[model samples]
Target: SKLFGHLSSNSSPLFIMPTGRTLTRTEFVKRLREVISSFGINSPLYSGHSLRIGAASTAAKAGLPIYLIKILGRWSSEAYRRYISVSSSTISNAFVLMSKI
Candidate 1:
């Protein structure tokens, strides 16, 4: 019996324990840590929210428009702006580009 497997007889739930129960937040976090650690990221600081932040940061770095980034992140408020973390070089490059105009 797999702890997290779908019973072929049932197809409603995408993920469920052998007991047909959804994972609690703690269990989910533990599994998240295990997966992260397997990838050589043993940091205890990673959480579910980290995924969201990473997505926003990556999109911002990729030069996606702010409106599109907000749409991709499903952020209705300006809170998504805070999730974007740009490198100092990016800022310096922006200033250089601005001066060219």
Candidate 2:
């Protein structure tokens, strides 16, 4: 799986120093900024978490089953339900049934 593959490739040592040091959040952000700059994206709209939200939102819009999305995102069922809940407009449209009086 992509997650497993990423984890395998991103291994780090327990003690991160000059010889075996882990990157701090600031360093990670700097590296991300450098990559974005390299792409010449002056105003990138998306960040790392954007990708996660995008995936969940896309799946919801596409009408995929919520359980499948939960598995894909590794979210708890309640969290997944909250994540994919539809807007008022969508729910109203879906259930707007009228019969002749």
Candidate 3:
């Protein structure tokens, strides 16, 4: 099984520092900024919230029900609607697929 996969070799907690301590929110944000900046995205708009938005949008694009996406995102309110961004092309493709069905 995947339990013995090389990626799972580290027994430490999934989110930890080199010293095996859980990362502070500040440190996590700093590291996230660094990684995003390294990719030549100098915009400060990309934060942890971006990850949530991306997940919800990706789930939506994959044809997952909105209710399921809400649950997967652990969203408590309709605010989740603001997180999922569906592009025009995605909607067009969905319409074409549904027409075939």
The CA lDDT of each predicted structure is: 0.79, 0.63, 0.76
lDDT of 3: 0.76
In model 3, pairs of residues that clash are none
| Model 2: residue 54 alpha-carbon error in angstroms | 0.9
Considering every candidate listed, which one attains the maximal lDDT?
1
Residue pairs clashing in model 2 are 16-20, 16-21, 17-20, 17-21
Clashes per candidate (backbone, < 3 Å): 0, 4, 0
Residues 12-95 of candidate 2 have per-residue lDDT tens digits of 432255856676755655666778788888625545555467778888988878776766666655665554546788777677
In model 2, the runs with Cα more than 4 Å from the true position are 1-45, 85-89, 97-101
What's the TM-score of each model vs. the native? 0.69, 0.46, 0.67
**Tens-digit per-residue lDDT, 12-37, candidate 3:** 43467778789876777788999988
The worst-scoring run of ten residues by lDDT in candidate 2 lies at: 6-15
In angstroms, the error of model 3 at 19 is 5.0
Candidate ranking (TM-score, best to worst): 1, 3, 2
For model 3, what is the error of residue 35's alpha carbon versus the real structure, in angstroms, after optimal superposition? Answer: 0.8
- TM-score for candidate 3, please give it: 0.67
C-alpha lDDT (0 to 100) for residue 53 of candidate 1: 94
Quote the lDDT for 10 in model 2: 53
The whole-model C-alpha lDDT of candidate 2 against the native structure comes to: 0.63
